[model samples]
Target: MSRTVTLALVDSAGTPLGALPSFGVPEPWWQEVGSIVDGARRRYGVEVSVLRLLTADRAAPPGGCVSYLAEVGAPPRVPLAPVTVDLAPQPRRAPWAQPGGPARSLAWAKRELDRLGRPVTGVNQQRSWNLSAIWRLDGPQGSAWLKQVPAFFRHEAAVLRWLATATPDLAPTLLAADDTGRILLDHIPGDDRYAADQAERAAIAADQHTVQRRAIGDADALVAAGVPDLRGPTLARWIRDRLAGHDTSVVADLLADLDARMDRVRACGLPDTLVHGDLHPGNVRGDGRSRTIIDWGDAFVGHPAFDILELTEGLDEIDTAPLVAAWAARWRAERPDSDPERAVDLLRPVAALRLAAVYAMFLANIEPSEHPYHRDDVPACLERAAGLA
Candidate 1:
């Protein structure tokens, strides 16, 4: 006998999109929904679709409530009547509420939205309260993207606001921000791209460098004013620190080589700049004509070379040399007196450090235990950083 599990997708109005059915008899069938859909599509030649459903575990306010059901599953073969439940109307908590309630964030977003005269539309409770809402008005001042900010999300919003103000022509316009860090900004249309061609890639890198150079001056002033530096330690120090805990002879030899290269890196001495912190192709947007950077959570004060490193991560090694050369040429053109060769040399370690740090962060947060890339690539990154030393 065939066994199946059913799921539903409901919107903010509590309306059901449809019921999804999965054919399986496993402990956690919900987790394998994607695989099941793919298998079904391949085996039966049927198009499968999935929708995000928001259902609360307990009747409570939107913020404090949990999305007991928000997943992708197989659509039911037969239509079923929509089921409605009389859920209690409790005070909504901010979606970003953790083990301890962050009531301040809720008050902040609400107050700001009220000032803008807009209602919260769609919200994703996972990975913090990520709300994508719209505020509509008449004329040119119509439509804004409202986002709720948890403590961790403040950096991203701050970076976006900074870019919007400093490089208005290059970034989205900020409408308003509140004490709780909730933000309302002008929305730009276009999807982030992963695969960019040579010229287009060079152009985006140029724009990023321009913004970094401009922001760095301000960042240095912030440092001078006694603001604690958020940029992490230098690439050399980071490699040594990670190596202290690592257990591998290959890594040890690589670290020795990296130690020797420290002088070379110091001699290069690339100037500090306001780095985007994460500048991979995935975070970059636009056709060769114009580019937009999304997700600025990693913004920090660091070497411009470090930003280049982040951009080239996961790409094949064969492409690194030419890309680095192109980037250095652009940097020199912008700052005519600067030595492009020295800057390019500095990028090697900067790249290593950024890659290692990011891989460590990803292993800590995103990857599963059985993922081989985490087990292997992370150590490989450390070794590469050591080699750069």
Candidate 2:
């Protein structure tokens, strides 16, 4: 289902003028707000861009995607209530969000934290994504991060709780999780370590290997907790389906290769384990003493090296060897009969393709303004995949 975004107009006096209820599907980013600004111009006689977006904690003011708060030049002439406006639909925002703003979301966050007995003495950072963003809430027990997820994103709290039973340090301790899918997690406090050497990253791969292998038996429980199985055929179909919408020859060649050799990708001799779908440096937090993995949103059940593949971002074929060895050693230690090199050989192309597809999909959906962020990099990623192929 496409996402709907609601808007709240703010008058010159800083008072809110209620939410703009009806909108087109797939809430757009900055560029897509022009129509909304025009709406305010036509109805309120003022051109506006002072848009502040937030997601309703629950069912959006009846049927809206999020409760957007826009700064209007003055109080709206119409009654301060939800208004409907038709728009040319554009695909963007995720399929979960409700009508609520910073105020409502913060109130809900404070309430949820209070219910969890974690008082918000201070807020470290403000939120962004409609109201479905994550924020660090300082509390009596150090600090905690309150994250609001979509109705369909599954409960990470349960997965965290389960992970805590074994490798408690591998994941954050769950503070509270409600039926609405808001998860309060203990914030790992410390300074961000900028540079991570191969050894430091190697330890992370090993840690991931251990945690994933231990959780293999409970795949059903983990998937039940919302983690997906993205290994083998699932990935093949996913890459194929996403690329089918594009007509570029670069993409066509990639698709052809995938279609022809996907069976080899499926037959890679590796044991399926808990996979952290994205394992780049930015996602891992280390304060010198320890490392904590963040953002399991892309996690799935897949090959072990796949979990650590993102770490090889800038490395050439030669540099990725040691990292692959470290990850494979852990897998080999667990399963003596498995051939790590063979598995790596088979998955190398698929992994590169997977990473390229990920970037390609992002490039396709993103706006021109967003292009700067990926212009040089995403194509480079595709080139790497093509080189591997």
Q: Tell me the tens digit of each residue's lDDT in model 1 across 1-389.
A: 22243334333333444443434433231222343344434544433322222343323222222222222233334553364422332233333322112233434544555666665553222122222212222224344554544343456556666676778666766667655546666556565678876665666677887787677668865445332244433555654554454444655654555545545554554566677776787777665466787656556666677667666666676776677787787777776666757755645655665556555544443323112224466667767766765
Q: What is the TM-score of each candidate against the true structure?
A: 0.60, 0.69
Candidate 1 local Cα displacement, residue 269, angstroms = 4.6
Off by over 4 Å in 2: 1-99, 126-132, 149-158, 179-181, 251-254, 257-262, 316-319, 359-380
Per-residue C-alpha lDDT of model 2 across residues 1-389, encoded as one tens digit per residue: 34355566655444545665455534334223444545555555654433334444342223345445455545656555654422222354322222233344457778877876777887633333332456667867567776765443444556677778868887877777767657777778554333667787777777787788788787777767767666666777877665554433554565666644556644545666677777776667878788887766566766676766677767777778888887777767777777777766656667776766665666565433234334454455556666765
Q: What is the lDDT of residue 343 in candidate 1?
A: 56
**Candidate 2 clash total?**
16
Model 1 earns a TM-score of: 0.60
How much is the lDDT of residue 90 in candidate 2?
Answer: 30
Cα error, residue 353 of model 2, in Å, equals: 2.8
What lDDT does model 1 reach?
0.51
Worst 10 residues of 1 by lDDT: 124-133
lDDT of each: 0.51, 0.60
